[model samples]
Target chain A: MNAAFALIARDVRLAWRHPNEIATILAFFVIAASLFPFGIGPEPQILARVAIGIVWVTALLACLMSLDRLFQAEVEDGSLDLLVTAPAPLELLALAKVVAQWITTALPLIVISPIVATMLHLPADGYATLLLTLVLGTPGLSLFGGIGAALSVNARRGGALLALIVLPLTVPILIFAVAAVDAAIAGLSPRPHLFLLAGLSVFALTIAPFAMAASLRQAAE
Target chain B: MNWHRFASPSNFKRLSARIFPWAAGGAALCLGCGLYQALLVSPPDYQQGQSVRIMYIHVPAAWMAMFVYANLALAGAATLVWRHPLAEVAGRAMAPIGAAFTFLCLATGSLWGKPMWGTWWEWDARLTSVLILFFVYLAYMALNNAFDDATRGARASAVLALVGAVNLPIIKFSVDWWNTLHQPASVMRLDGPAIHPSMLWPLLAMGVGYTLLFVVLALVRIQAELIERRLGALVQARLSAEPAA
Candidate 1:
């Protein structure tokens, strides 16, 4: 547990030192979400209707963009080998990396989602539910993206391949997250959708660590 | 009989060679009869007219899509858990074929939909999930060939295949819950068959033919992979020997 915490702290600190990476993701989130009104015409009702979806989809893409560098720096500096060989369990360590990644990437997106939501003229009732879904759902994105990052770490071309591998795995998260907010907007109970979103996060938590560890091991070899 | 003996590449090569002819012949016979029965003998749907015949192809191709992914996942397990060389070869060979089946399923479904549903596509749960499955197959293939090292590519893709296998059912379930416009299953229900015998027979025949076709194609491809690896090894050996000389 201490080793895992140390790893997380280190990763968080590393990300903190490089504020531009986080800024780029945040900027991309707001800018990309803002483009929809132009593409679909500046009609408030249409933007309001589709705001939650735009937020969720752009957040997914931003998460993918951040993932390409998840392991690249570590691999280049040869610290990945040390981590693999460390006495701490690789799976625990992998979970630490994912937690750190989520904190660095998805958390900021979650923070700025409301601004994007408002920019899209999202319905008033959906704001809380949208934030709630982001909290519950983005962890799964980071978790699955960790697997893609690990698998593609050794590939000659990792960027596109990583997105291709991770996006399909994230479909469930996107579905339930948007459903919850849509339910809230429609004045229906969001409980079932929220519960399902939470369940998916828990499921990804259990499964992703080992897959990430295994892929990391292969890449380290 | 020691099944482990056939896990050896050489022995597996011989074994697949023996099975290929039989599988090919069975595929030919089944597909010939199935198409003949489907196009010539089976009656058209009262509502859909001749377009219902597209189901005869779409449904079977859909089955093959899921079936091939399951096999790929199993082969992925064999590669990762046991480090079985033959499994690695088989998994690589199967990815593209599975992808082709998935494409065929989607295309034929769209063709059917244009006339029947009045739209070429709908974001229906079944259709969406199947589209996601197709993307997963593409990802598997892309990951399988991403690395210069063959073994690394194989193992990395094996992990991906397993992850995909676990996610597919969840994706299907979530999408089903989200929304659905596609018709419910008529063939594989817990209650007895739903469709009439007249249509059921040809669909069954086509399903069997597709499976046999997959087997024959897989065997041929696996053999080709083995031969390529052997030739690669020979070239490497000759290069090394020339340096010494």
Candidate 2:
């Protein structure tokens, strides 16, 4: 537990030292979300209808963009060797890394989603539901995306490969998140969708750490 | 006489070489017979008319997509647990063939959907899930080739294959849920033995043919990958033996 917290703190301090990384991620989310209106026309109805999907998708893309960075720096600087050989359990360490990723990547997206939601003219009532689902869903994204990041850590050109490897695995999260928000918009109960999202998050959290650790071991070899 | 002896690269190579010709020939024969039965012998669907014929290709292709992935995951498990090099080779060899069948399934499904569902695509559960399966295949193939060292790439991708195996069930459940949720009247209804006995036999034959083709292709590719790696090692050994220039 102490080792995990220490690792998390180390990652957080690194991010704090370079705030621009977080800023770029947030900016990318906003920019990607903004492109939708221009591409799909500025009509209010269409904009509102697509607002949740656009935010979720852009958030997903933003997660992918940062995922490669998750292990790339460690691998390049050769610290991954230390992590691999550390006495602390690798799975716990992997979980710590994913937690740090959620803090740095998904947290910012959650913060900025409402503004993007407003810019896209989403109904005010949907804000709470959207936030609820994102809170439940983004951890899954970080964890699963961690698997992709670990798998691609050794690849020379991994961005497109990372997307191909991660996006399909993320389809369930996307589906449930969108369903919950869509239900809210349509004046229906989103309880089931939210429950499903929760289920996925729990499942990802349980499995991703071990999987990432295994992949990291392979990459380090 | 233990079967495990064949797990060695050299023995597997000889075995695959021996089986390749027979599997290929059987696949060819089955494909010919199946197509003949499907096109000429089976009666047209009373409702879908000629378009129903696409099922002879599409359904089997879809089945092979899922079947190949299941085998790939099993091979992945074998690689991870026992570090069997042939398992890794088979996993690598199967990826592209699985992806091609998935593409065929999607394409032929689209062609069939156009004349029947009036749209080239629908977000129907089965179609959507199968599409996700295709993505899974692409990801597996991409991850498998991404590393510099062959063993490292294969092991990394084997881990990935096991992890992504979860997607299969999610796709299945999502399709079932989506189907019930929407339950549209205009969708292609496939409930029971909607297909006649004659059509059924042809479909089964095609299914067998596609499976045989997959086995033959996988064996050939796996052997090729093994031989290529061996050749690479031999060349490296010779080059190293020559000393520094």
TM-score of 2: 0.95
lDDT of 2 by residue, B172-204 (tens): 785667566667655756544566788889899
* Candidate 1 ranges with C-alpha deviation above 4 Å: B1-8, B181-193, B243-245
Give the DockQ (C-alpha) for candidate 2. Answer: 0.71
User: lDDT per prediction?
Assistant: 0.89, 0.87
The superposed Cα distance between candidate 2 and the true structure at residue B188, in angstroms, equals 1.9
lDDT agreement of model 2 with the native? 0.87
Which pairs clash in the backbone of model 2? Answer: none
lDDT of 1 by residue, B32-149 (tens): 9999999989999776789888988998999999999999999999999998888998999999999999999999878987886778986666677889999999999999999988
True contacts kept of each: 0.88, 0.73
DockQ metric, candidate 1:
0.87
Compose the digit string of candidate 1's lDDT tens values, residues A1-221: 99999999999999999999999999999899989998999899999888899999999999999999888778999999999999999999989998999999999999989999999999999999999999999999999999999999978779999999999999989989998898899899999989999999999998999999999999898
Clashing pairs in 1: none
